[model samples]
Target: MAVRTQVKFYYDVLSPYAWFGFEALCRYQKPWDLDLQLRPINLGKIKKESGNISPGPCADVFKGSLFFPDVQRTSEMMELPYKPLKDFEESVFIKGSLPTQKTLAACQILYPDNMEELTRQSWLGLYSHDMDMTDKGNILQFAEAAQIPDVDKLLEFSVGNEAKQQLISNTTEALESKCFGAPWFMVTNPKTGRREKFFGQDRVEMLGWVLGKEYVGHHPSQ
Candidate 1:
C-alpha cells in the first residue's frame, strides 16, 4: 500500500487569500486523498523578521496586480464567498496571529477524534462567522456554534502558556522549514519523511500537481 501524503497548512486569518485557498482544500479533500496537517504560525513574527508590513501602499499594488484577482477567480470557480476588503476590526497585533493560534489549539483539541466536524467548524468560524477569533469569548461562541462539548477545556487550553509555546514552536518550525509567509503548504512523504513546500494562497493547482492530479487552470480575466 502506498503511504498517504501529509500536507502541512500554515495559515494567518488576516489574509483573505488564505481563506479562499483553505476552502478549496476542504472542497477537494476526498477527491485528492490528502491527510492535512494544520499548523498555525505567527505571521507577525515572520513579518518582523523579514521586514514586511500589511496594508501598506504595496498591498494596494498587489491587490490590483495579482492577489485579489486570483482569489476572485478562485472564489467564483468554487462558488465561495469573496469580499475584496471587508471591514475587519484591526488589531495592534500583526496579521491576525492570536486568533489563528486559538483556532489551532482548538483543532488540536478536536483532531483525530472529531476531525471532520472540527475541520468544518473551524473553517466556518474563520470565513463565515467573522468572529474576532483572538477573543476567548468569541472562541467560546464558536465552540458553541460547532456544538463541541468540551468548549471550556478547549478555551482554557487555548489561553494557557502551553498554547503560547506551541505557537512559538510552530512558528520556529515553519521558519526552519523555509517558509516566509502565510498559507504555506508542504507535502511530506510518509515513507521517507521527505518534504516539499509551496508558499502563498494561489498555489492550489501546484498542490494538486504535487499530489498527481490534473488541476483546473485559473487565471485573472483581463
Candidate 2:
C-alpha cells in the first residue's frame, strides 16, 4: 500500500480563493491518498504577524474592478458557488472575518471531526448566503447549518481565550511555514519525511506532482 501524505490546509473564509483551494483539495483527497487536515487560521492575524498591511482589493481601483468577475470565472471553472456581496464593507471588511474564524477554531477544538463541515458552512454563510457575519446570531446559524452539537457551548467557547489563542497559534504556524496567503498547504510526505509547502488555490497540479499522482483537474467528473 502507498503511504498517505498528510496535508494541513490553512485557510480563512476571508479569501474566496481559499474556498476554491479547500473544495479542490477535498475532491483530490481520496484519489491522491491524502489525510487532509483542516486548519482554519485568521488571515488578518497572519498578515499582521508577517508585517503585511497591504490594502484590500476595494482600496485599489483596477484590482477591485477585476475582482468579482475573476471570482466568477474561477468559481465557474472549479464548479463552486460564490455570490459576492454588493460591497466589501458588508463582506470581507465586516470585522475582517474575525468572528467566523474564531468560531471555526472553536469547532476545530471541540469537534475536530466536523471542522470541514463547520468551515464550509462558515464560508457559505459569508460568500453564498450573505449573512451578517458580525452578528452572533448569524454566526451561530453557521454551526446550526453544520449540525454541530452543543452550539451554545460552541459560541460560548468561541469568545474564550482557548479558541482565540488557538486561532492565533494557527496563524503563527502558517506564517512560520512562510505562508503569505490563504489556502497555504503544509504537506508531509509520510514515506520520504519531506516537508513541503504550497500557496494559492491554483496549486493542485503542483500538489499532484508532490504526491506522485496525475493531475486530473478539479472535479473532472463534474
Candidate 3:
C-alpha cells in the first residue's frame, strides 16, 4: 500500500490569519490526497515558549486594514465570500472558555460531516459574527446559527474528561512537532518518521510542492 501523507495543522481560534489558512486547507483537500491532522493548542502557550507577544491585536488591525481591497481583488478572482474585517475588531477578543469550547464543539460537528466546515465555522464564529467565542452563551448562539443543536450537550463534551485529555494529547503532539505558532502544518512520514513543517497559509502551496503534488495558487490578492 502506498503510504498516506499526513498534514497536521496547528491552530488557535484567536487568529484571523489562522482562519485564512483553514480555508486554504479546505481548498487543497482533493488535489493533494491530504490526510489532515488537526492539532489545536493554545497560541498563548506557543507564544510563551517562543518569547513572543500575542499577534491578536496587531494582526487583527492589519488584517482589517488590508482586508477590503484584498477581499475585492480576491473575490473577483475566486468565488469565496470577501467580507472585510474593518468593523471586526471586537470579535478578536479571545476569552479562554468560549473559544476553547467552540473550537472543540465545531470539531464535534465536523468530525462527522466534513472537517473542513468544522474548521471554517469555528473561524466564522470569531471573525465573521464578531462574537466572543469563549462565552458559553455566545458559543451556543453560534452553534445554533451553524445548525448544531444541543449546545448544552456539545459544551458538556467540550469540557468532559475525554475532551480535556485529547486536547492535552494534541498539545503534546504539537510541541513534539517542533512548532510553536499558529497556522502551522506538519506532515510525518509514517515509514521514515520524517516530518515536514510549513508555517503560515502562504506556505501551503509549498506543502503541495514538498509532497510531489501540483500547487493550486491562492488568490493573488492574498
Candidate 4:
C-alpha cells in the first residue's frame, strides 16, 4: 500500500484568507492523497512571539481598499463562500478570538476524526453566517454541524483550563515551527523526509509542486 503524503494546515479563524485556504485544502485532500491535519492557533499570540505585524482587513487606508476586492475575486476563483464579518471591529479587534480558538482546539482534542469538518463549520459560522463565534451557543452549533458525538460536553470542556492550555500549546507549536501568519502550510516531503513550510493563501500551487501533485490554481473540486 502507498503511504499517503502528510500536510499540516495551521490557521486562525480570524482571517478570511485562512477560510479560503481551509476550503481549498479540504477540497483537494482526497485527490491529492493527503493526510491533512488541521491545527487551530491564536494569531495574536503568533504575531507577538514572532515580532511580526499583521495587516488587518481594514488596517489602514491604502491596503484596506484592496482587501475586499481581492477577497471577492479569490473566493470566486476558489468557489468558497465569502462575506465580510457583520461586526468586524468586535470580531477582529475588541471581543477577540480566545474563546473561539479554545473551542476549536477542544474539538481537535476530543474529535480528531471530525477536525476538518468542525473547523469548516466553525469558520462558516463566523465568516459566512455572521455568527459571533465567541458565544458558546454558536460554538456548540458548530460542533453540532460537524456531527460531533457530544456537543454539550464539548462546549463545557471548551471553557475549562484544559482547552485554554491546549490552544496555548498549539500556538507555541506554530511559533516554534516558524509560523508568523494564519493559513500556514507544513508539508512533509515523502521521499526526502523533510518538512517544508509555506505561509499564506496564494501558496496552493507551490504546495502542489512540493507534493508532486498537479496544480490547477485552487482546488477545483470545490
Report every candidate's CA lDDT.
Answer: 0.63, 0.84, 0.63, 0.83
Best by lDDT: 2
Candidate 1 lands at a TM-score of 0.77
- Give the lDDT of residue 97 in candidate 2: 81
In candidate 3, where is summed lDDT lowest over 10 consecutive residues? 93-102
- Residue-wise C-alpha lDDT for candidate 1, range 149-168, written one tens digit per residue: 67677666777777777777
Q: Would you list the clashing residue pairs of candidate 4?
A: none
Residue 172 of model 2: what lDDT? Answer: 85
How close is every model to the real structure, measured as TM-score?
A: 0.77, 0.93, 0.75, 0.94
* Alpha carbon lDDT at 181, candidate 2: 75
Judged by whole-model lDDT over C-alpha atoms, candidate 1 comes out at 0.63
lDDT of 4 by residue, 10-98 (tens): 88888889888878777778888889988889998898888876666556677777877888898888777778777687888777777
Candidate 3 residue-wise lDDT at 132: 60
Q: Give the winner by TM-score: 2 or 3.
A: 2
Better of 2 and 3 by lDDT: 2
Q: Candidate 2 has what TM-score?
A: 0.93
Candidate 3, 25-111: lDDT as tens digits: 767766666677666776666666776555443556765566556644644454545454544445453244335633563454434
